[model samples]
Target: MDEFLEKVFEAAFKRESEQDENIVRSLPFFVAALGLVLAIFSQVVVRMPPVGTIASAFLYVLFGSATAIFSNILWCLFQLVRARDFKLPPNEERLLEWADSLQKFHKTGKRTRKAAEELAIVDVRRRLVEAYAEAAVDNRKSNRHKFKYRAQGFMGLVLLMVLASASVGVIFFDKTWRISHGQGATAEAAFPPPHREKRIDRTVRDGEAQASGAGSAD
Candidate 1:
């Protein structure tokens, strides 16, 4: 009964540990998502025009930054490999060897057999524990094989945003500028007469010219 209870408690503890591990592994992605939203609001939805243009640069920067974050994540996969097959520390190996020596007996054969089976179980648990720890590392980061795809995802979203903004600007402001130009033309059409005299008229006919010249010279 005591042995059964011990096994039950061990199983329960293992389950909880697994849950904690998964949460830890997922934290990076959660942080990335949170930053994404904050960045969008800060760089986008909150305002418009001149400032937005300046902020668009940030979209590109964010993608590059996210890639950098993911690259570090790839390095973590190596840690997982290390945990799985890499030699255990001295104390751990000694303990594991002791367990392996115990697995040689069958329960029906002798007391030693029971101890051996227990040892085997312990070895299995050891391997699983290593795997669990390795898996607990954050997965939101990108390895070299997966990096191109993540970069594409970030850049694609930014490009789409830029296009959407441009489309909206053309929709909203293009007509307004056109209307303003039209009104300016109409105002010029109604402008008052010339600011200065365009000509000074001097008219002289053949007979009138002859009389004017006869009096002028004398």
Candidate 2:
């Protein structure tokens, strides 16, 4: 039972060596930074939002973060998959082996550093250099567009916002023109107030003359 428990603990909360932990943490961070920039460039911002602005803003942040994290994950996965296709570089492996050899030489003080140097390690590095002479094809940068995996939804939303902005501009223009025309109509209507006053004055004078003539006849 104790052995089983120990195995379970190892599976659940296994501790990574310090070097491995550093590499794991740093690699994710470095890879994520790339996606962060890509996501930022890909995102669109909205301004002068309507009544539901706060709610919409919150939704935007939520979706945006999810997209950025997903993108980061995708980027990390891509790198891992690509690296898997290529066997561990001989140079990298040899470099590690050479360090181990140096440590062993130091521990066994009887052995000279020259005797500790492995010819196979030198040959490994040499083979790596000769095999890829002047041709270092970094697949990530070279086949960047090969994935054909785009955030279509994100781009669609960006274009939709642009169209919406143009639509709003058109609406505002129409309303402004309508208000100006309405004001002109009001001014025109007001211009004939003097004519109305003249008609009213003539009516009053005619009535007065009729009343005076009627009194004289009586």
lDDT of 2 by residue, 124-217 (tens): 4454453333222332322333233233323434444444444445445543564677854553344445677799789999999999999999
Best by lDDT: 1
TM-score of each: 0.29, 0.26
What C-alpha lDDT does candidate 2 achieve relative to the native structure?
0.46
lDDT of 1: 0.47
Poorly placed runs, candidate 2 (over 4 Å):
1-118, 127-138, 141-143, 146-162, 183-218
Give the least accurate 10-residue stretch of model 1, judged by summed lDDT: 192-201
Prediction 1 TM-score vs. true:
0.29
* Residue range 71-165, candidate 1, lDDT tens digits: 54444333332332222223667666765654653344555755768767866566545544443333222132234433444454455445445
Taken over the whole model, the C-alpha lDDT of each candidate is 0.47, 0.46
